[model samples]
Target: MFNEVRRRRAVQRVRPGDGRALKRFRWWQLPFRALFYLRLTRDDGRRTVCAVDVRHWRNNSSGNVKACLYVDGRQHARSGLPAAFPVPGGVVEVRMSAFGLKRCHYVTADGAEYQLVPDGDSAEGRRAHFDRRHPALSRGVGFLSSIVLVVAVFLLVVQLAEQLTRADGVSPYVGAFSSPVDLSAWGNSVVGLITLTASTERALRLRHSWLLDGAAG
Candidate 1:
């Protein structure tokens, strides 16, 4: 019920876009821009191209960001973050996270889902390319990221537990406890930085976990 309401509000944010050509991704926009593409052939034997473009830094100015949908290179429709744009036989869903995009998929009427391909010049595209070029190394890096996030989450839980046990109201019920992996302020800072990098790396692959990326974000 709650999810249905949120979906309706998100649909309400959709607005028709004035036909404008989509711009090519540039090197300077690497940190702020993300672009993805989908190609489909109709029953009539006609090919169509769909693109999803987002500019992350704009949220800093307006506190709200939007996703733009393009068809065959021209703007088709747009909506605020978490957009759902209707296309030929499916809806293109775009979602953002604090670090970058968490989702960009095409869902067909029959429930089939597919991730759109990132623009070749974008960071996500480069990451995908690396995965293809160096499958073994890529898997190793991905595994390392998961390990880092898991350790970070565990430490976080331990610290929270210790803190809760120290509270006066809770101390009597659950005696004072200390974290086994104690770290100084500087050490904590380093861990925070490492976890942030791990989260960003995972984001590039559109991999997110509520307990991991959520806490990092």
Candidate 2:
């Protein structure tokens, strides 16, 4: 079975207005183009706020596209451009207004447009939505994993060098004893060569395994 996975935050909108009216608007008219919409209304009964909207799409790579905002049918001031939209990504904070009477509109990248209405107690909804959707990671697991792998390889090389040193063969003293220092030097050289070859092989094997795993994944 094919599963449909929604991209988080592909598009977002915010509408602040009167509390009671915003609730009615959400139930009746908020656009379904949003994966979800959040509304916020202030406690003082005077301010309303909407949170960003998350959109679902396939290709979001288009760099920051200029968007024109309209307030109650009149062109509003253009704000700073938003972050680049990514493929399969969502948008946020599409619109905002105060009190139940004000409305806002946004014209997005592909010429798709959205309308927002402000209602009471909507600002809280907006804050909640932002908090829930904000991307946060617990830790840098990939970086830590790479660091551990490097350390392991270094230790393995050291262990292999020790084994190679012990594997070196020395000639036995038969008729006359050779200089002990010379015998020791010869043994050390043999061990060094063995260690070099072993280390090279080990490194190649590690790299090969990494590539194989990556391909499989």
Tens digit per residue, CA lDDT, model 1, 1-217:
6744665676677899899999999999988899999998877889999999999866523367878999999999988888888888867888887778999988787878899999989999999999999999999999999999999998888998999999999999879988999888898899999999998898899988888999877
TM-score of each: 0.94, 0.19
- Candidate models: Cα lDDT each: 0.88, 0.30
Mind sharing the TM-score for model 2?
0.19
Point to the candidate with the largest TM-score: 1
RMSD of 1: 1.8
RMSD of each: 1.8, 22.0
Candidate 2 per-residue lDDT, tens place, 92-156, comes to: 23321111111233334354534343233244334234434652421232233344445444544
Off by over 4 Å in 1: 1-8, 60-62
For model 2, the run of ten residues with the poorest summed lDDT = 94-103
